[model samples]
Target: MVFFNKVGKVALGSRLRLMTAIITDDAAKVYELYEADFMPKWFPVFYTLTEEREITITEIANEIGHSQPSVSKIVQEMITAGLVNDNLKTTDKRRNIVALTEKGLILSKKIKLQCIDVEAAVESLISESNHNLWAALEEWEFLLEQKSLFKRVNEQKKMRESQDVQIIEYTPEYQEAFKALNEEWISTYFEMEEADYKALDNPKEYILDKGGKILVALYKNEPVGVCALIKMNDENYDFEMAKMAVSPKAQGKSIGWLLGEAIVKNAKELGASKLYLESNTILKPAINLYHKLGFEKVSGLATPYKRCNIQMELIIK
Candidate 1:
């Protein structure tokens, strides 16, 4: 109890396992009292086969929400116990179909009567509890399905890490960082094009001085990411999002997302109606990040960079 209290929510899996063990042990005792030779773990598969008459291993897994391998193992155990038969499909010999045997059918019929009393007993047990554990479990299952624990934890982690990150406007001191960050990613994937050097080598002269903005992300007071909102005189777009890069060490800190978001917000503040971007599909993560930032695929606009094979735009207005 002391350990669980100290660990708090971190012991969720342990608590769930303890609850499952208690319920499973009671089920085993019930089967023993009825003189039934069955394992509590087999109930889900057995019930599914009895209802479906015949189903493939994959189908059983889908129906019971268990992994195919787990369902296959349970089916094999039932087959060994002479309670089920595993047959290959006539049309597709590679596929297996499971069905209850005569022994299984007889046992299922006996269990049907047991289920009536068991359901009532479980309902009474629930009524005895302060809260409806069954309903709470259903809600927990739905919420977990909506967004997994992995994603939820990672979101919290990003939020915590992002607190250490600070987004600031372009300054002369960060000129080298802006150039190096973009050059690192560009050189890693493709050769730095003439247009890349023109803009990266002199961001202030080429971007900021010409009614544009550059945003820098500093992680723990170190420049880790940079992006630019290059103002454009195009009829469709007011700015072109360019030179976005996150240092490899700070990749998972959500700096890229924060920079993109800051760029968008800045563009809107500057009375920009739409933002444009150019990239190659080969850079999947960058393309995905653009999409997440509300950028949609667009064409008909020529680009100076040889590496630009795709173009996307975001409508801020």
Candidate 2:
């Protein structure tokens, strides 16, 4: 027997390939010993054609779970060996049909008897095992048909991540996250200015002490996003929604939208009349989200950061 030293410990795919090769080799030997006129590989196409009588190459490929090209190649070989006939359909000249010849029919009779013995041998081997490998294989195939292995794994990963995400009011513990999340994006796109650092580094002094509120998004209890609503004026209840950030890994799960919505809801509770924000035009997706959340473009707004070229405001009605 051919063997690799670590083959037994390999993954399922490698083990299945090895098993298929071993079984095909053994079946070829058995066919030779019985003096069968056909190879083991030809058995599937031959047996299917015999049962199907007259069928297209495409039909045989579908029935046997093989590519049409592969079945067509095998059919050509069978035609050359005088074991099968390939003819163009009179009604549909474009379609080619395959049928077993007299010699193939005789071989099919012999193979049918041999197949019974092979089935008994396979049953005996399975009966000796503690677990039913055949039933497990069928179950696995059914599950895979329902959804591909790749899609199932990806959906599972998304579900686990979604379960861990939670949005909450900011606390002292999230002070570093408030700074780090904002700094990460600002440093990547534009230089971090003094105003950015002041607001990020000292949220309590610059924001909370000024009657503003901050919100943080947590993934598995770890802060990944932050957004702040700064009080602009007390008389008209005006506020500036600024200093929003989400980590690179936590960007695509609508975390920013959730943070924005949470802050807007808080603004309503605080009796704010207008919510304003300063941002650059380069941030297309962020701007798009702002537009979606009822924020519209407005000119002539003073900004502390140099990156602020576009200003938007939402009238909280």
Q: Please report the candidate that would top TM-score against the real structure.
A: 1
lDDT of each: 0.92, 0.86
Q: What is the lDDT of residue 56 in candidate 2?
A: 93
The TM-score of predicted model 1 comes to 0.90
- lDDT per residue as tens, model 2, 194-235: 999889889999999998999998887889899999989535
The reply for model 1, stretches above 4 Å from the true place, is 88-95
Clashing pairs in 1: none
lDDT of candidate 1 over 151-255, digit per residue (tens): 999999999999999999989999999999999999999999889988988887899899999999999999999999998889999999999999999988899
C-alpha positional error of residue 13 in candidate 1 after TM-score superposition, expressed in Å: 1.0
Once fitted onto the true fold, the runs of candidate 2 whose alpha carbons sit more than 4 angstroms away are 1-10, 155-317
Q: Which residue pairs come into collision in candidate 2?
A: none
Winning candidate number (lDDT): 1
